[model samples]
Target: MDNEDKKQDIKDDENKEQNIEKEIDNNKISDEDKKNTEKDNIDSSKNTSSKSSLETKERDWFFEPKKDGSPSTVPSDVENVIKNHSTYFLGDTSEKVIYLTFDEGYENGYTGKILDVLKANNIKAAFFVVTPYIKTNKDLIKRMVDEGHLVCNHSVHHPSMAQVALKSKEKFKEEFTGVEEIFKEVTGKEMPKFFRPPMGKYSELSLAYTKELGYKTIFWSFAYNDWNVDKQPDPESAKKRIVDKAHNGAIYLLHAVSKTNTEILDSVIKELKAKGFRFASLEELK
Candidate 1:
């Protein structure tokens, strides 16, 4: 071949080598980009998982009490969570109605009198009773049912329902079904599909589990420190606290274990009735 032709051939070989090298570099860069993209996707997935967990964490039901008879305020997100689960804390805000609910963890020798007051007032209330309460106070449970009141499942062992639900869905199911089985045995009827989490502690996951069981989780709009029998609020103060906090759709949570509640329940009902607030059953909640 001529010397010029040989030189041209050499130049062509060098250009091919350069192009091959550039192609290898581009493949390496593409591999590195693929790895980086995978890592970014993993990080985004972890963030989404963390956010989902936070959204379902346990929450204590709370409301800001208003003394001027305005509907109490709950945190918007908390309210949304309750509402999304078909749960209820307040009823129709347009009507002056109150839903009276009693949490009976155990017998404190006051439920009978409270029932008497309710019977006298023609107020049908809901009584959330734990398994122990149902087992030991079968007569009271019977009385609650016979008097046209609702005997709701408050859980079997009264553990944090949210924690129970997170640990095992079957266990959570048992918490409710256990109470229901015994209630049916005692009453010869199927228990009402109502529930109240132990100590007002719940989560979106727990509430969802409850809803799946065909139950409406009942929360309260008005509650005082009446659960502690030892540190019961003064009867007069409790009556005023209850009466003054009376809103259009108040769900008053009273502990049946409180002697003070038994003492003041009748008067509170009368005072609220005087103020044109009618007692409503949970079945009647709008």
Candidate 2:
């Protein structure tokens, strides 16, 4: 009887050890699942943030700054057309010269090639840069400045001046001095001479304000639909449109992001040269 009781107690101890082992295995599986779920949540959040950034940038191309310096009063239909008018093609009056100005808002992947084309041809052009572009792309901007290219202000937020009321001197200061301050902050140089409105949309009041701030309003007369990245013009067509439309004192406004511009730039320069046209920087013109 004593031997049987001891055997029974040993059997119970073995069973208890087995149960504890099973519980530990289950706990480990639960922990692994929790870790995986947390990792998936983090990945989902990163994707959402990326999508949000792309959306914000796409919408920002046309919106104007509000009274509080945030995006507001964005006219969806006319804003793009208004902003592009700064690249006017005024035909030659005193001499056969065309002014070339490129707007560098952000890299769309074609600025370096454009610069290479200009540099290879030994031609000079004006570059209009915003604050962020100047800061982040400082190496490129400095190269432009060092290579004798003119760097001008295109406004801090690229805000349209036509939207401003300009009811007071402070309003005028905001329109002109605001951009100047940004250029000064980035390059450590004062820019008080020339400015182009965010989108060619400007009121007479805005022009007067600019002049009061010792700035000349730059407007373009010739531009093509090259800002649309997906619907790009063919290289041949871009070359033709530009070569045919160019006139004396024409300021051609081309976005640096256009692939057609990069592909056809060399030919355009050569053809213009063959046509007895000379290229001039914005500063070189009267």
Candidate 3:
């Protein structure tokens, strides 16, 4: 009777050990499955992020010109990028307003007259200056600041910022900080946190970096081929083109080097003012 009881008890203990081993194996399998699932999810997320990064390629700012005095039409994707990066090309369309911006790559002997016209009109505009321009034209830059105009960064070497940004974020930042350092040295004031990509060339990455650097990227709604100094457009025709293209929330990109722009700026301002379009500073942009 004692031997049989001992054998039965031994059998029961072995069964219990087998059951415990099974449970342990099941738990190991469960843990492995969970880890595998998590790895898959992480890999999937990384793939999606990589695809999104690939999609954010370089893009040039463009708009459809309309002579009906309506707001110009920009591509929906372009508009989305601008908004996503907190950038601006157009202002509040509900109000008739014009934001005048001049790109000064270099002094072409027209900036002073342009300044005189601006002073006479009591209109404050934004001047996007390059590092070279700021270095060479300190007085003009100072005048811009003194006159309540916004002196903004155009870049260090005025290359396509998208290219710079894609290469390295530090380099992209240097493009802005370079101008900022010089301008601060010249004007003794902090440069405005506004930027216009050189030649209106930019990309989503560039815009993102710009926003990270605490700058608002500015594009233009209306621009003509007035940058070529060798062949400036006729002032009368240029003025007609400018006034005809005047729409609500228009951001006009004029070359400060353009003699035609300097010649016709006063008339264009008066005409636009008469049409109930108030000139506004970028700071007033909604």
TM agreement with the true structure for every prediction? 0.81, 0.65, 0.88
Best by TM-score: 3
Q: Candidate 3: what lDDT?
A: 0.90
Clashes of 1: 0
Error of 1 at 92 (Å): 1.1
> Taking the tens digit of each residue's C-alpha lDDT, what string does model 1 give over 1-286?
9999999999999999999999999999999999999999999999987546635588888888776679988888887777778788898889999999999888989989998999999999999988888889999999999999999999999999889988888999999999999999999989989899998899988998898999999998988899888898998988988898899888888899998999988899899999999988899864
Tell me how many clashing residue pairs each candidate has.
Answer: 0, 14, 0
Worst 10 residues of 2 by lDDT: 54-63
Q: lDDT tens string, model 3, 109-166?
A: 8998999999999999999999999999989989889999999999999999888977
Where in model 1 is the C-alpha error above 4 Å?
Answer: 1-54
Better of 1 and 3 by TM-score: 3
- How accurate locally is residue 42 in candidate 1, as Cα lDDT from 0 to 100? 97
lDDT value, residue 242 of candidate 2: 86
Pitting candidate 1 against candidate 2, the one with the higher TM-score is 1
Residue 82 in model 2: shift from native, Å? 15
Which regions of candidate 2 are displaced past 4 Å? 1-92, 165-168
The lDDT for every candidate, in the order shown, is 0.90, 0.69, 0.90
Query: Each model's RMSD to truth, in Å?
Result: 5.7, 20.8, 2.8
Cα lDDT for residue 127, candidate 2: 81
